[model samples]
Each structure stands twice: as C-alpha cells, then as structure tokens.
Target chain A: MIEVFFQYDFLRYSLFTGVLIGILAPLTGVFIVVRRLSLLADALSHITLTGIAFSLLLGRYINFFAVLNPVYMGMIFAATGSLLIERLRHTYRFYRELAIPIILSSGIGIGVVFISLADGFTTDLFSYLFGSIAAISSTDFTVVLVLTTVVVAIFGLFYKELFFLSFDEEQAVISGIPRRSLHFLFILITAVVIGISMQIVGILLVSALMTLPVAAAMRLAASFKQMFFYSVVIGEVSVLAGIFAAFHLDVAPGGMIVVVNVLILLIVLAATSEKILNRKGG
Target chain B: MKNSAAPYVLEVKNVSFSYGKQMVLEDINMQVREGSFLGLVGPNGSGKSTFMKLLLGLLKADKGNIELFGSPVQSFRDWSRIGFVSQKANSFNSGFPATVFEVVAMGLYGKIGLFRFLKKEHKKKIKEAIAQVGMEQYMHKNIGRLSGGQQQRVFIARALVSEPELLILDEPTVGVDADSVRNFYDMLKELNDKKNITLILVTHDIGAMSEYVTDVACLNKCLHFHGDKNDFEVNREEMMTAMYGHKVNVIEHNHSHDHHDHSHDHDDLDGVRS
Candidate 1:
C-alpha cells in the first residue's frame, strides 16, 4: 500500500491535493463558522457544481472546452455566484439569509439543466460528484497548489482585520477596516476554495470538509486561535485517513473523509459534554 | 493632526439626520469638552444611537458639520484615537469561540494596521488592558462562557487596548446586573478621572450615571437640555418631563453612604415610570 503511492502518479497527486485542501478549507472555515455563514459555503459549493456541469456540457460541442479544466469554470461560476449573493443580501436587507437559499436553488437548478444537456451524468461526472482517487491529475495538483499559496498569503496579510470583522462587523466598520472590500474579498475567496476543493471532496461534500472540522474544533478549543489550530489538525487527519482508507477500500474519498469528520465531532461532543456534567456535579 | 490642546473633543453643529421622509434627529447642536464625562440620555427611539453613529462616521449627517479632534469627520482618519463599545456588545453571539484575550487583541487591529503581526509590546498592551478591566483571571476563558457584565468589561478592555483619547459606550449596562452595572460605571469613571480619557456614555440610566458624568444631555429628536450635572440635578423633574412628554422620577443614589447597595436604583428611566 505504501509502495502504491510512489508507483502511481494519480495516487500521489490526489494525496498532495488532499493535503492542500485540508489546510485551506479549515483555515477559511474558522471565519465562516464564527460569522455564522456555514450555509454560505454549502451554497457556493452548489454554485461551483453549476460551473462544473456547464463545462461538461460545453465540452460536447466546443473543442476548446474539452481541453479546459472544469475546475476553472467552477471557480468562475462560484465567484460570480458569490457576488450575486452579496448583491441580493443588500437587496433584501432585512432577510439577509434569503440570499443563501436563492443562490443555492439557482445553483442546483442550473446545474441539473447543464447535466441534462450533457446527456445526463457520465462516469466523469460521477467522479467529480463523489470524488475518485484515480481522477486527480497533475493539472489538478498544480491548480490546488497555486490556489493554496494565494489563499494562504491573503489570510496572512489580513488575518487580524478578518478576525475583527468576523467578531463584530459594526465595530470593524467604525474603526476604518474597509468592511465592504474585505467582505467582498472574503466571500470571493470562499467561492474559490469551494470550487477548487471539489476535486478531492466533491461539490456535494465540500462544505462538510470545510465546516465539520471547525465544528469539532469549536467544541474543544478555548480560543479562536486554538480553534483554528485544532480545525486544521482535524482536517488534515480526516483527509489523510480518508484518502488512505478510500484507496484500500476502493470507495469515494469524499464520503470517507466526511464520515471521519463526523466521528471526530461526535467524540469531541461526548468528551465536552462529560466535562460540563462533571463540573456541574462537583 | 490631533489638536491635543483643543477644548472640545467632539463638536456637532446643526446636525440633522433622517431615514427617508422620517426625521430621526433634527438640528442637534452639542459639544463634548475635553476630559469631561458626558452621559447622553434619551428614551428609546430618541436618536441616541443614530447620534452616536454619526459621531463614529458610520452614518453621514444630512444637514450639518461634525468634527472630531478639530478635524472634519469626512477627512479625520485617526480612528484608533477614538474607541467605541456599541450597545450590541453584550448582545453578541455567545457561541463565538474567542477567548477574552483574543477578543481584546482585536481592538488593536486597526491601530496595528494591515499586514502586521502582534509584537511583544502589543501583547503586553493587551494583557495590561485586560488587567485594567479586572479580567486577567479569565484571560483564557471563552468569551461566550462569561457573564453579561464580564463580557461587557472585556469589550471595554478591548476599547482601552488601543489607548484611545476618547471612549464611547452605548447602553453598556443593558443586560448587566445591578452590582456589575455599578462596577462598570465606576470603571468608566476611573478611566475618565485617572486616565483622562474623555468619555461619552449613551444610556437610559441617567439617574445612576448622574454620580459619575460631568455633563448630561437629554435628547428627544432634539437636544432638550445640555448642561452641567448640577443643573441637570436641580431641574431633573422638569427637564425629564419635558423630554419624555410625561412626569418622571429621578432617584439620586448617594454613593458615600451605600455604594454597594444598588438594588433600589437598579432600573433605568423606563423602569421608573412614576
């Protein structure tokens, strides 16, 4: 099993891609969960699916589309969807969460239409939806690598500002934090993360990979920094274990990774609950 | 450029604000002198929050000029010099996974500027601010697990971390208990007196605040009364009746005799209907 990784380029590519996504997803996930925008990740992932499906559909007729990676289209569609969500949130104002459902439904609706136009779900679509170990190519690895570098750099530069904005938006705005541009950049980055992560985790389960580790970490960690640290640790563990198990079991890595995350969350919840009960008893 | 020698820290001249056709504040003129603790008291929907927003540059005044530190608010960029703790500070999501230390550290983000990490001096400042708020023991505790009063104190610590020249608090004692409210006010008074940080506290509890505030400004779509606390105390009944459009009772708690016992003066003006 260990020799298989060195022998097979696909296995090595998928493993490296998983490692990068594991770091990026949870890093951004901390902010998303804290801001109570967990559902926004799910909506954006669905929107990325629209891009993926559109690319697949276009490949049938357009020679250029056949060579182009669907993940790029997914990223483009996801970015557009994120901007629309921001615009709609302002439009509704009072019903801000309305933006999530509207975008979510439109994404899935448009995605289904595109999938149908592409003559229904093929094996390639299946791999993209559930994630396959063999499907990750060198090109996919390069995309993830570049995106990881850009996202990490942005997070590093604006870490404090982002933390302040997430905690209290009104106060951040009052303190001259450029709330509009920061928020715009935040959601745009979130969209790109969701789009790129779909290669290993699939669009359906991408949000889970982003959110579950944060949820589990929040239960155990005392501070935002601790939660961030713990979330990345949990994300890395789940992705590595899930990928390894998937290769051995010949199953979808996305499902295995989400299951591992769920297991970790349950364990953390149980442990924390017992601690709380003991504190009350003593 | 900060006019450190300027007599007034804030000046609002003929400021009028409206939301669409409805007027919230009308031609409000007020000045907060340097080193004075001004308590802005008003009934609900009396535009106290809106006034604070205008001062913080969150909202633009429709009809007048507002200045902070001798500079027009439109061009005044020294935000770190003015710290603000909003009314919603206590009402924040308790489930947020940040410690008291992490929460207080965020107050320096603006001052620290972009792309900069917290240095040793910044960390020392954060700890000192937490100590100043008397939250050192709970420095590592999750902010959500703390009591409303403790959380409010942490927010005040956050505001103080930047060492601002002016600190503005809006209804900071809304959900705080009677005892904690007294301590909160005492802390604000200490900040004003000892640190000489000019304070602007917007609250409904003008009765409790009268002990600490150097000046009082009663508002009801307009500045009904703005004067020294002594004048406010002398004409408390008449001024409150005129501002609230009804008879009101002003309970002045004597701090010298029973500083600890605040059960009688627990509620704000709304609680004291008579």
Candidate 2:
C-alpha cells in the first residue's frame, strides 16, 4: 500500500487534489456562511450528482456525446442547476429557499433512477461517489489546480466588493457598486466552486467540505476575516489528516475525508458550547 | 418631466413608479441643490424611499426622467461624489468575518471602480473617515462587535470615506435606543453645518429632522410640500393632511419610533440580498 502511494502517478494526483480542495472549500464556505446561503451549497452539490449520473447513463445507454467526459458534463449540469434555481426563485417572487427543496428532490430522484438503470456500480462507483486515491489522471490534476488558483484569485480580488454586497447590499447599490452585475458574478462564482468540487469531493458530499470548517470557525470568531482565517486553518488540518488516514486504512478517501470533517465539527461545537456556557455561568 | 433649466444637484420632475399595476409614487417633482441639507419626511409607505430610489437609479421612474448631478446613469457610473446609508444599516450577516476597516473601505469601491482594487490613498481616506466619525478606536474591531450607534458611525464613515458631496440616509435611526439616535443626528448635523456636506436623511423622525434639516421634502404618492423646516412651524396641518391623505390627529407619535407596519406601498429590505 505504501509502495502504491509512492509508485503511482495517480496517487500523486490524488494527493494534490486533496490539498487543493482542502484550502478552496473553506474559502468559499466563509462567503456562503456570510451571505447566509449555507444550505444552498448542499442543494447545488446534490444537483451535481444528478448531472454526473445522467451523463454516465447518456454516455453508456444513448451513446450520445460518447467521447465527452462525464465529469465535464456533470460540471455543466450542476452550474445550470444553480442558475435554474436562481431563475425560478426570482420568477416566483418568493423566498429563494422555496426552490431548494424542489431542486433537491429532483436531484435525488434522478440520481436514484440512474443508479438503478446503470446495473449498479462497484469500487469504480466508489471512485466517483466516495473518491479514489488511485483513479486520477494528469488531466484531472490540472483541472483541480486551475480551479484552485482561479477561485483563490477571484475571492482575493473581489473581497471588498463581495464584502460590501454581503453586509449591506442596499448600501452597495446606493453607492453605485453595480450590484446587479456583482450579484450575477457572485452566483456564477458559487456555481464554479461547486462545479470544480465535484471532481474530488463528488456530489455526495461536496457541501460538507464547503460548510463544515466554516461552521467550526464560526464557533469562536466574531469577525468575518477571523472566521475565514479559522475556517481555512481548520479545513487544511482536516484534509491533511483525512488524507493521512485514508493512506493508512485502505478505505475510500472521499467518505473518510467527510467523516473526519464531521468529527471536527462535532468537537468544535462541543468545545464552543462549553465555553459559552462557562461565560454565562461566570 | 425633465426640468433642464433648474441647476439642482437632484431632480425628480413629475415622476411616477409602480410595481405591476399598483402605483408606488405619482407625479413626484422634487429638487435639491448641491450644498444644502435636504430632509425627506413622510409616514411609512408614503413613497419617500421610492423617491430616493428614483434618484439613486435603484428603480427607474415609470413616467419621468430622474436626474442626478447632470444626468442619472452618467453620475451613476461615477458615484464617488455621492454617499448613502439605508435604514437596515448593520443588520447583515452578523457572523461575517470582516473587520471595521474592511467595511468602511467598501464605500470607496465606486472610487476604486471595476477591475481595480483600493490604493494607498484609498486606505488613507478610510482611516480619516473613521476618525472623523469618532470610530477610529474601533477601526480594527469586527463590525458586529460595536453598538448600534457605533455601527451607524462606521456606515457614515463608509459614506464619508469617498468624500461625496451629497450624502443620503434612509431611516437610519429606527430600532435604536434614544441616546444613540440623538448621537446619530448630532453627527449628521455636524457634518452638514461644519463640513458643508449636503445630506438627505429620510425618516419618520420629524422633530429631529425639522431641527437639523436646511430644507424639508414630504413625500406621499407625490411631492406634498417642501421648503424650510419653518414651513412645518407655519403649515404643519396642511403638510400632515397632504401626507396622510386626510386629517390625522398629530398626537403622541409625533417624535418617536413610529413603526408603520401596515404600509403596503414600499418594498421591505429586512433580508440581505445575496
């Protein structure tokens, strides 16, 4: 197993993918939390899963777009999913949250139908579902690398505008911040992050990677910058540990990674609640 | 509806706006000069905010041309000369991760413009604006940690950060305690009187606005009555009747946090748009 880790180029790709996702997830997560759209991430992620299943079925059954990559198809589908959800919410003139359940059910229903029709999957399905440390291509590595770089750069450059829009959108619009353009940009960025996340975390649990560390970070940090800092620090730690454990245990890296993140969240909540109670008691 | 001859900083001449078929504002003609404080006063849903929106280009007037500075979109593309604070000032994601410095820095985003970031001079302006609002001590503090009045100062600093000639505030004092509201008005008056920065504060707090404003404009579906606050001292009944559409007994709620929840005309901004 150790030899496999060192010997395979795929293993190297997997390691790089893990590290990239580790940092990127929580960076975007802070924005989601700040904007109060944490659950929206979960809904979009499930939409990605449905897209992947649909693409795989199309490639296998219909033989249409036979040469196209299923992962790429999934990315496009998920982005469209996010966009459609946004559009429907606007058209309905109600809370955007109303679209969440409808989209979520559609994703799950389509995923179930595809899973049943595909004659079931094996460890290869595990590769797509829970992630594989042994199935990455150089191409996949490059994709993940580009995604990480672009996400980081976009967030850094637009930090002020996004902050302004998130905190006081009316103020941003009133001060002539080109808020409608920024609003579209923000949703597009979220779709991009979710699109890229499907490569490693997969649709099954991408939002966990995106949301868990931020939830933990929110425990102690009062300010947005501090919350972002703590979320990234915690995310990096979880990914490193998840990768290490996956390396030793011979289990699926994706499930292990999310489980590790959940454990960290629980621990953070426990620790925070105690401190809050103590502060009150004192 | 465009009053081209009037050399006012803002003009909404005979304008009207509506959502679907329901008219929100009707035949609203108003103007403000560059260096004068303009108080926007009305009951809730009386089209005060809608009028502000027409001027800010947030919502377009259905029937008239709204002008700002020289033109609407022209100055909209360049709003460094204007500052604004909405009623829901700091009620955003309270658990957000930014400090006070970052929040104030966003005021200069228009000055910074698209495809660029804040420069050294921008940072200096942010610091100076914070100090001017007496929030220099809280510059490094998280925006959520401050009290309501302090948060308001940060917002005002954000407005002042860009050194705008015109500053417009919408219902900035509701949901706040008495002393904080007083402090907010004091700061606003000081800005107008001392710095010569023009202000347009929209609120139901009539007495405070009447005391501080150089000019007053009451909005219902139309421009009711506008002149100096002394117009209120002389013609209060007429203005109130025009605003309410009937004779309203001007009693205890005259100078208080009168939350007019039954108002159906204006849109609610309680939720953060994300």
Candidate 3:
C-alpha cells in the first residue's frame, strides 16, 4: 500500500482525484440532503452513465469529441443531464418524481445501447464504473482540477442564499436574496459537482458519495455550518482511507469508499449517538 | 408628546388581496401609532396574516397603499424596521444544531447584509434581546432542544435582536400551553411597556392578548373594527357583530392547545368583513 503511493503516477492522480471528489461531493450533498433533493443526485448520476457510453461509442466513430478522452466527454454529457433534470423538475411541480424516472431510465437504456454498439468491453468504461485510478490522465486531471475550483467558488459565493432557500425559501425570497438567480446557480453548481465526481465514484454511486457523509454528519452537527464542516471531514476520511485500502487489495475503490463511509457511520452512530434521544426530543 | 403627538409608524390604506381569484382582504385600512400594542382578532381567515404580509412586503395587495415610518409608497426599501414571526417560520427541524445565538443571529441577515459580518454592537443587541426573552440560561443550548414555547421565545428573541420599530406576531401563541400563553403575553406587555416597541399581534386568544393590547382590530376578509381595548371590551359583541358583514358572537375559549400544529394556511372564516 505504501509502495503504491510513489510506484505509479496513476496512484497519485487517483489519490488526488479521490480527495477532491471527497470534498466536493459532500459539500454539494449537504445542500441536496437538506433541500430534500437527494433523489435528484441519483437521477443526475444515472444520466452520466449514458454520457460515458456515448463518449465510448463516439470515440470509435467520429472520434473528435472523444479526442478529449472519454471522461471529459462523459462529464459534458452529464452536465447537460443535470440541467435537464432541473428544467423537468421545475416544470412538473406535483409530479417532480417524473423527471427522475425520465432521466434515470433513459440513461440506463442509452448505456445498454452504447455498450452494444462498441461491441467490445472498453477498459476505460469498467474503470469509470467501479472506478480505476489507472485511467486518470493529465487532461482528465486538469478538468477535474478546474471543476473542483469552480464548484468550491460557487458554493462559497452562494452559501447563505442556498442555506436560506433550503431552510426557509419563502423567507429567503422575502428578504430579497435574489432567489431565482440563486436557484439556477445552485443547479449549475450541482452539475459541475456531479461532473467532477464521475471519475472517482463513477456514474453509478456518485450520488452516494455525495449523500452518505451528510447523512452521517447530520447525527452529530448542531447547525448548518457545522454540518457542512463535519460532512466534508467525514467524506475526506472515507475516500482517502478507502482508496488506500483498495490500493493494497487491488479492489474497486468506489465500493471500498462507500463501505468505509458506511462503516464509519456505524461506529460514529454507536459512539456518540443515543437512540433514546428522541424520547426527550424537542 | 401628547396622546396624538406620536407619528403613525404603519399605515395600511384600503388594501385588498385575493388568492388566485378568491378575495381574502377587501378594502382594509388601519393605522398604528409609533408605540402601541395592537391585537388582531378574527374567527379564522380574517385576513390578519395576509395584512401582516402586506405590511411586511411579503405579499403585494391588489389595491391600496402601505406606508411604514412615514415613507411614501416607494420609500420603504427593506422593512428592517418591521420584525415578523409567523407560524410556518417555526417549522425548522428540532434536530438543527444551531444554538439560540446562531438562530437569533439570522434575523440580522437583512440589517447586516453581505460582505460585512456582524459587529460588536450587533452581538450586544443579540445578547440584550436573548436576555429580554428570558432565555439567557439556554443561550448555548441547541435550538431544537427547546420546547415549543421556548422555541417561539427564541424566534421572538431573534426579532427583538433586530430592534425593529414594529414587531409583528402571527399566532405566536399556537402550540403553546395555556399556562405559557399568559406568560408570553406578560412578557410581550413588558416589552411593549419597557422597550416601547410597537407590537401588532394577530391571535385567536382574544381574552388573554386583549388584556395586554392597547387596541384591538377585528377582521374577517376586510377590516371589521379596531380601537382602544377599553372601547373594544365595552362594546365587545355588539361592536364585533356590527363590524362583520354577518352577525358573529365569538365565544372566547382557552387558546392553550397544540399550538405547534398551527398551520400557516388561514382557515376560512365565515363572517363577512365590514
């Protein structure tokens, strides 16, 4: 495990990607969980699957869009998927769940079609799914870096507005927080986050990477600010530790990361939490 | 200043509002002095909450004008002078980790604005407001840990911390026990007397709130009547019945029930507005 750190540049890139994904996923996930948009994350990630498949198929055919590598192509497609989810969700107020199914099922259907069109299993697609640090290239690394910086900046600028909207939207609007602009900006930020997370966590469990830390953090933190702080810390730990363990075992880092987070959650729940607290609940 | 010396802090002139196509408030007009406790009473759907919203600029009226602190229609930019506490506003999850100070500090979001953080004076004011609400002991406690009444007190403290000229309360007594309602009113009366803050309280607790309020305003969809408590108490039934388009003999009941269950949606009050 220790030798893996310096032996391969892939390991270095993977660790770097894992750390960034760990921070960005849960930061955005805190917004998702608090706003009751957890399902939206899943819906968006499934759409990324379709993007990955398209990138692969196009790489074989037209090749230019894929010239940038499959991951960037997939990211661009997933961002579009994120935007579509927001539009559909907004249009269908009462039946917002309709948007989820449309994006999710269509994404899966596209995945199947593209995989068949490519004929042979691409090494990149498998790595993209279960996650492989071996595939992280300089170009893909650059995109991930830019995406992280943008996501972090957006989150910081719109932090208060987003918090208010999640907690008390009407109050936020009444206070002249420029809610409509903030809402769109928030969705745009989510797309960027989902795009960056695609490499490490894959199209499959990217949403899980976003949500599990927040879910775990909610048990311990007392305020929105504290929740964000702890959720990020928890996410970083799980990803770094899980990726290190996966390196030693030659297993899928995505599954390891999710499992580590779940295990950490259980330990935290056991250590600090009292189920009986609800009895004296306010 | 004499009895008439104080300037009008809030003036609602012939305001009317409709939800979709249904009219809620029709031709409502009222004036509040700089320092006064005004009680709003109606069976339900008396447009009391609607009026408060109109006053707070939360909702726009179909017709009429609202003036705050002698401002012309366009002059009242942000209503920092007006503090508000609505029933739905208390729906924050109890498990929320914010301490009473952090929760109360949110009220200053408008006053403090972005870029600049809260200053020392703001902290002092927050402490003073928390002290005023008698929750200083629980200042560090997570807001979710507090009881319903205490939670409401925290909200009141939040509003008070802003040093609003006109403090608006919309059914703040909801979910609170009967014992707490009196204490809440007493606390309010003290704030009104001590701080000299103008209070406009919309409530169903006519008996208790009425005792503390200097004046009363009754509504159903439009203004029914509003005047000094002495005038209201003297004429009670006759005055209220006459003001409503339909005759109503409201029976005062103990308003100590599951106030936490208070819905923001105004229930349909059958009585007609004057």
Candidate 4:
C-alpha cells in the first residue's frame, strides 16, 4: 500500500480521502445516531447526488462549469437541502421525519431530470453514485481534508453544547445553549460531511459510512467520549479494509467500504449479543 | 418564606401564551422571591410545564413581561444565574450515552461559552453539583444505566453545576419511587435553605407540593391562587375548586403519608377530590 501510494498519486489521493472520510463520517455520525437523525444523512446524500447531476449537465454545455469541481456544487445543494430540511421539520413539527423523505424524493426527482437532460449515463455519474478508486483526484483529497478539519474544529468548539443538546434538548434550551443556531450549524455541518464524503464513499453508501460505525460503537461504548472514540476507530478500520479489499477484488470502493462496515456491525452485534440479551431479560 | 434580604429572583407580569388557537396560559401573574421554595401545581394540560418554559425563555410569551433577576427575559443573557430542569428530563433519551459527570458539566457550557474549555474550577463545580445531589458515587457511571430517580438526580446536578441563584424544576419526579421522591425534595430543600437558592417546582404531587414548598401557586390555564402554603391550606377547598372549575373535597393527610404503597392513599385522595 505504501509503495503503491508512492508510485501512484491517484492511489495516494484515494487512500488519503478514504482515511479522513472514515474519521469525519463516524465522528459526526455519533451525533446523528444519538439524535435519531440518521435519515437526515440519507436525505443530504441524495441532495448531493442531485447537485452532482446538475453540475454534470451544466459542464456538458457551459465553459465555466466544465472546469469547476462538481463537489463544490454538490456542497451548495446539500447545504440548501439541509436548510430546507430544517425548515420543513419546523413547519411540520409533529412529523419531524417528514423532512427527510420530502427532501430525498425531490433530490431523486431533480437528479433524474438532470441525468436525462445531460443525454444519459456517463462514467463520472457512475463513480459519483457508487464511488471509484480511480475517480478520486488531488482536489477531492483537499476538499475532504478541509471538511474533516471543519468538522473537528466545530466539535472542539461546541463539544459540551452539542452533547447537552443531543442528550436533552429541553435542558439545552433552558440552559440557553442557543439551540436554534447550534442546531442549524449542526445540520449544515452534516450536509458538508455528506458532500465531501460522497467522492470516496459515494452518494448512496456515504450515509452508511456515517452511521454504521456509530451504530456498532453505541452497543458497547460506556460514555459519549468512548462512543466517539470507538466510532472513529471502527470507521478507520472499515475504510482501510474496504480500500484494500476493493484494490484486490476489483470492486467499487464505496460499496466495499459499506460492506466492511456492515461486517463490523454484525461482528459487534454477535460479540455483544449475549450481554444485550441478558440485560433485556434482567 | 424566609425574607432573608432576598430580592425577587423571578417576576412574571400578566404573562399569557398560546399555541396556535389554543390558549395554553392566560393572564398569568407570578413573582418568585429569593430563597423561597415554590410549588406550582396543576392538572395535566394545565400549562405548568409551559409556564416554566416561559420563565426559562424556552417559549416566548404571547403577551406580558418576564424578568429574571430584574432583567427582562428577552435581555436575560445570564443563564448561569437561572437553572432549569425540564419536565421531560427524566423521560428524554433514557439511553443517552453520557456519564453523570459529563452531564452535570453541561450546565456550565453556557457560562463556559464558546471556543473555551472547562477549567479546574468548572470541574470542581461539576463534582460539587453531583455530590450535592448525592450522586458522587455514580459520577463516572453512564446516565442510561441509572434508574429513573437516579437519572433525575443527575439532571438536578446538571442544573446545580451552574450555581444558579434560582432553580426551576418541572415535574422532576414523575416516575420516581416514593423514597426517591422524598429524598429528591429533601435535597431541593437543602439547596434552598443552605445555599439560598430560590426554587420553583412544578409537580402534580399536591401532597408533596403542600409539604415541601414554602409557597403554593394553583394554576389551570390561569393563576387561581398564589400565596404562602399556610394560606393555601386555609383556602384549600376554594383553590381546588378554582383549579378544577368545580367543588372538590380537600383531604387532610399527614405530612409523612407518602409511601411506596400509595395506590390506596391515592385512591382515597382521588375519591375525596372527585
């Protein structure tokens, strides 16, 4: 792997982006899982797909868009989708989850229209849908790196506030944690995470990379910090293993990564099943 | 109520709030003095929790003004001076993966502000808050692993960690056992008496409210009665009548009547009230 990275810049970019996405995805996923907003990630991922599809369509005709990175457009759409989700959730307060499906459907609707208008399927669209090792560029690596840094920095700044909000939103509000702004920031960050991660993990499987490790971690972790650490570790391992497997097995890295995460989840469930069952029985 | 040179910790003047077309709170007037334990009692859907939310600025009042520590609620940025334990604190996210200490430390987050970190003094305050709630033994314990009452205490500790001058709790002991409920009130009393912390407790347990609180406020979408506990006792029937919008028998139960097998006692109380 070291020799391959040294020999091929594409491999280096691919692996680098993979590892960072691994860390950032599950770190934010801890909050998503805890908040029961895992569906929001799925919605945001679909929105990113729509953005990619639209950018692709524009690139086919427009000189400026042809040179621009599609990920930037993906991020803008994802962020807009996040704000819309927040708005819809607030508007339909009782049916908060309603935002997810509405956004997801709209994303697919727009994406399908854009793909059709662009005169059909392309290799780039396929890579964005399922992620390809050969598709990652140095620019994609930089974007992922910057996004990961932002996520880490946000957490560092608002760790306690986020924890309180996630743990007990009522208390967080009463404690005056600026619930509205903080929550908005959180969803925006979630959008950005999905946008950056979709290059390696792909739009369809990106939510899995965000959620699966945290889901596995939640079963055994004793505290919030422990859950976060375990999720990051699990994510890192899954990403590395998936990348290696994809290299050897000649498969899409996104699908391979998600498969690795599912395997890890199953193993964790198997190992902790007895204790969980006993707990329930007792 | 102990005068104790205590100023008004909270003041609500003609406050009214509504959700959509439904009037949740109507023309409410209340003032909580410093070093006072006030029990706010009402039936389900009586807006007890909504009233707390208004005071805590969680819900904006449709009309009227609220002041915390002499500052208008809209301008009251010093949240550390006011602690709130919401009604759903017990039932919210029971499986939340946080330790007792971590949960308590969250109380200081607003005061600690953004971009800064918890200091040594903040850690000490967190520990002290946990110890105050008698949850020191479970400082490192996962909040989800604790019993309902234990989790409630952790929430109280979280509120206390901020060292607020006034603490507001909305139904803090909903599912707690008799013993734990008793202990919970005793802890609140201790905080009020020893620390001069003004307390506004919203509870359905009128019996506990009458016993532990220095003052009583009867509410039902409106302020029916607000006075000392003795005065509330003197006008008990009238207060209950105003609260239920019908005549109700006031049961004469002893202070120590709360027990684990409270079903029978509750039946009798219900029989009298109904």
Best by TM-score: 1
DockQ scores of the candidates: 0.43, 0.44, 0.28, 0.41
lDDT, residue B94, model 4 = 58
Q: Which stretches of candidate 4 lie over 4 Å from their true place?
A: B245-274
Considering lDDT, where higher is better, how would the candidates rank from best to worst?
1, 4, 3, 2
For A176-211, candidate 1 gives per-residue lDDT tens digits of 777778888999999989877888888889999989
By TM-score, the better pick of 2 and 4 is 4
TM-score of 2: 0.89
Comparing 3 and 4 on DockQ, the stronger one: 4
**Chain B, candidate 1: TM-score:** 0.89
**Candidate 2 residue lDDT tens string, A209-255:** 88889888988686667888888888888776777688788776667
- Taking the tens digit of each residue's C-alpha lDDT, what string does model 2 give over B76-113? 55677878886667666555656789888888886787
Count clashes in each candidate, considering only residues at least 3 apart in sequence or on different chains.
Answer: 0, 6, 7, 0
Best by lDDT: 1
Write the residue-wise lDDT of candidate 3 on B110-210 in tens digits: 67765456679888888888998999999887787778889899989877777888898988988777788779999999888888899989876677776
Model 2 spans with C-alpha error above 4 angstroms = A1-4, A58-69, A274-282, B1-7, B73-75, B245-256, B260-274
lDDT of 3 by residue, A161-252 (tens): 67766766655555555666666777767766776776777777788888899988988887778898999999999899888887778888
- TM-score of each candidate structure, all chains considered together: 0.93, 0.89, 0.89, 0.92
Mind giving the per-residue lDDT tens digits that candidate 4 earns over A1-282? 547765788988888888888889999999999988999999999999899889989998998999887878998999999999988887877667888999999999999999999988888888899987776778767767777887899988888888877887766766667777888899889988888788887899999998999989988788899999999999999999998888878898898898989999999999999978887886
Model 1 whole-model lDDT (C-alpha atoms): 0.86
DockQ, prediction 1: 0.43
Model 3's alpha-carbon lDDT is 0.77
